[model samples]
Structure formats: C-alpha cells, structure tokens
Target: MTKRSKAFNIKKGDTVKVIAGKDKGAEGKVISVLIDDQRVIVEGVNRVKKHEKVVNQGGGNTGGIVTTEAPIHVSNVMLVDGEGVTRVGFRREEATKTRADGSTYTVQRSVRVSRKTGKDI
Candidate 1:
C-alpha cells in the first residue's frame, strides 16, 4: 500500500520568504502547492523565461518569450508571520461545535502555530 504524505502548513495564498536559493530573502504570496513533489510556487520568486513558437489555435496564434514563476522546493521557503519568518508547529485544541441535529459536541482540531511566537497562525 502507498502511504499518503501529510499536508504542509504552507497553503495557497500564504506569504512566505525564501530562505535558500538564488531568490533567497525574497518574500511573496504562495501561488500554488505541489504536494507530491514537496514544492511550491511563490509569487515573484524563482522566475524563469520560456521560449515558445507561435501556433494557430481556435483564437489566434500568440506565442513568444514567457516569463513566469517556477516551482521552489518547500524546504527553501519559510512561512512569514507578523514578526518575520517562523517555523510552523501543530497544536491540538478542543472546541465545541453544533451538529445538524442541534447537538453540541466537543471536537479536537489541529491548528498551525508559530514556533517563534507560540501563537496560532
């Protein structure tokens, strides 16, 4: 059986700072996540240019040099908090929730916390 990997704390739309690589110290919002490859694409980070040939499509033939952000390994980036870049930690908390039957139940939820500040992110 294949094992499923745990989800990363850094989600889409999260602000992250690149810690290592050519774009080190660059900060930008996360564009997408590649869980299988353990990589992420950050806005304005790891940009690369691609040359393309013009092709005729249903619309029109419009192709040229396209520059876009490339995927960066997740380990090279750190989540950014109000203080600065911080490591992520998980915290379990009990919370009460209402069910469809109007019954209250206590459930445990895992929340992502900042290691540096010791607060929920």
Candidate 2:
C-alpha cells in the first residue's frame, strides 16, 4: 500500500489568514496543502515571480515572467472561522460506520473545532 500523508487541521478550500511573513493579514482560500513539507499555498498570497524559458514556439506552455502563489509554512497561517481567525482544535466524537461484511461499528473520529466559538469549523 502507498504511504499515507500526515493529517493537518487545515485543508484545501479552507479560508486562511496569513499570520506572518510578507503577506501578513491577508486572507484567501487554500489552493493546496503540502503535508510532508508542512506548507500550504493560499490563493493570492505569498506570490512570487518566476521567469520561464519557452519550450517551443508553437504556443505550448508559453514562457514568460509568471507570478504565482508560493507555499508558506503552515504555522504562518490561521484558519478563518466565522468572523475572525481562530486556532484550530481537534476533538473526537463517536461515529457509526458500516463494515464491508455488513456489520456496523462505532468509531471515534477527530473533528476540527474552532477555539474561539467552541463550535465545529
């Protein structure tokens, strides 16, 4: 079996605010998560420019100076919950699951919680 990536409190499509670095105070939707590196790419945040060389003159993968969002350390961002940013907390709750053979079982699953509101985020 393929190795599994570590779970993170932040996930793709989550709104996050940059807490440090050049993009501090900026809030944007999460574009992707880098589990191993503990970094995340937030839309329109931590943008960097890269110059590319044209691979072909036929309009395939046109090369030029491109500005794109760079991955920032996960610690530099805070998940946006409700009206403001809040620290992420995890709690376990019982959930029912169906077995492959048709048996039902209860399992505890970790849920993301908002530190500020004490509600599921």
> Per-residue alpha-carbon lDDT of model 1 for 46-107, expressed as tens digits?
99999878889886658899999999999999999995899999999999999999999999
Number of backbone collisions per candidate, in order?
Answer: 0, 0
Please give the CA lDDT of all the candidate structures: 0.93, 0.92
Per-residue CA lDDT of candidate 2, range 1-121, in tens? 6567677889999999999999899999999999988899999999999998878866677889999998999999999988899998999999999999999999999998999999998
Q: What TM-score, computed on C-alpha atoms, does each candidate reach?
A: 0.89, 0.87
TM-score of 1: 0.89
**CA shift of 98, model 2, Å:** 1.8
| Top model number, lDDT | 1
Residue 69 C-alpha lDDT in model 2: 90
Estimate the overall C-alpha local distance difference test score of candidate 2. Answer: 0.92
